[model samples]
Target: MDLSSVKEALAEKSFDKIADVCDNLMLQVASKGTAFHDDWPYAIHLLGYFYVDDCDSARFLWKTIPSSIKEKKPEVVAAWKIGQKLWTHDYAGVHGAIHGYDWSQEAKDLVAAFSDLYTKRMFQLLLSAYSTITIPELALFLGMTEDDATTYVVEKGWTVDATSQMVTVKKQAVKREQKVDSSKLQRLTEYVFHLEH
Candidate 1:
């Protein structure tokens, strides 16, 4: 595997392909007679999983990492801490882990993208799950300060009660775009007809 290509992808902030690159690297290393190398870029690999919201893969990767590498490379351990916080549903901890780490320039873009992706996902979850929630709780869930959270919710059209400090969630109707592949549907239909016969 070429480390330069991976570095290029990271420099370009091509997060969507990072996980696939790491997956390919893992398969290559796992091949018979293949030996582990010190320059595997495990930290980027782990962060790539988080970027794709694939915690299970991240957990598996963390387990396969050599203890010596984990001890020696603080960045890999730091990336895993983000995965741990995510796995445990510790929203506050997730924010803290992301902000606390001094990430390398290559990993910075993906890390910031993960934080934005997580915050957006949490906001969507809250919109559907809660009719009303407290300011502090909302702040914690959204990984923002109370003031910032309040301002964000207001911008989203949520109403905040000053006296109670409770925010009323404004649910937006999501238009799910359904694009049917006609050829695929036709093939499936033909297969079902043949099976019925």
Candidate 2:
């Protein structure tokens, strides 16, 4: 799959093939753009949005970016910061960026409301649920698997096959096995209940 493959797929209405091909093409197209600073991180930020649940990592990646790049390159820095905030689920961050752009007021409101914690929690769930699945299963959910989900999970020290119903790189497995006080799950449920309400 390459640039031409993407164009042809879109022409044929092959939406399922888009993510796989677009990942490669997005990187390639971004590489061509002239950024005073390298746009690799910014491009990666875009990928983070597609993953939805990887925002913690995405947010950290943005903040860790050295001032060396942020200070010198306004265009790259601007895009990076906006995308990073979007990944972090800071909706106001996006509003600040696109406020004066051609977007409609409704678009701005939608962007502003998007960072609600429920949305973040949903992505967090996805990252946990799909992290340990086989290439085939992941490809089904993500619409692409040109990358290895299992390797990513292992690298993060998450255990797999807990239920053995299917591989799930559950967040519970990654956390240390401390005795769970009922209070903890109680608080967790309350938090989610509050968020949902």
Candidate 3:
């Protein structure tokens, strides 16, 4: 999927579409390690961690997963370890001493849904505001270069300057506290940070 296309879809307030796109991108992370793949899963994990009130350790996991293991479930276990550590800190998120999680299909579905919804809605909310209201100002928001923003607009076909239309700010996204999943934080930490202790 094209970044510009995805970005455009986000700006258009098509969150469910973005989530589907993100799911595909996530599969790439599980398989290929694309740059887009690098961000979201770990970010979702960190959000789960943040909701649980321990971002520091979660941040650690965010930085670790890439270097940890090549398989999917070890990746899940690795993240769980960090999350458990964050829950209690002393050998917290590790395998033997996990905090509290039932191995249920519903729980798995919930986690998957939460992670997808969190990132999809998060980006859509942000981009929609920019595309509808303050597009020109988004470079400041992202701290990206003007050329990049211009390119984004050109490729994505966004209004880029919605001077003629007045978009009503709809309550599409329900605000919620994001807890970083210690599990994710731990994986990224192992893969990205290469922690040695």
> Which candidate gets the maximum lDDT versus the true structure?
1
User: What are the runs in model 1 whose C-alpha is more than 4 Å off?
Assistant: 174-197
Each prediction's TM-score versus the true structure: 0.84, 0.27, 0.23
Misplaced by over 4 Å in model 2 are 1-47, 50-53, 83-93, 99-197
What candidate 3 gets wrong by more than 4 Å, as runs, is: 1-54, 61-73, 77-107, 116-124, 133-197
Tens digits of per-residue lDDT, candidate 3, 1-197, equal 34454455445544335434544555665576555443244433443453334546565655566643325444455445545554563321232322234433312443444334433433354556543544434433333345554454445445443454322223345679999999999898988766565
lDDT digits (tens) for residues 26-64 of candidate 1: 676677557778778898998898888899999998999
Candidate 3 residue-wise lDDT at 178: 93
Preferred candidate (TM-score higher): 1 or 3: 1
Per-residue lDDT tens digits for candidate 2, residues 172-193, read 5455677988999999999999
Q: Rank the candidates by TM-score, best first.
A: 1, 2, 3
Question: Which candidate achieves the best TM-score against the true structure?
Answer: 1
Candidate 1 has its poorest 10 consecutive residues by lDDT at: 25-34
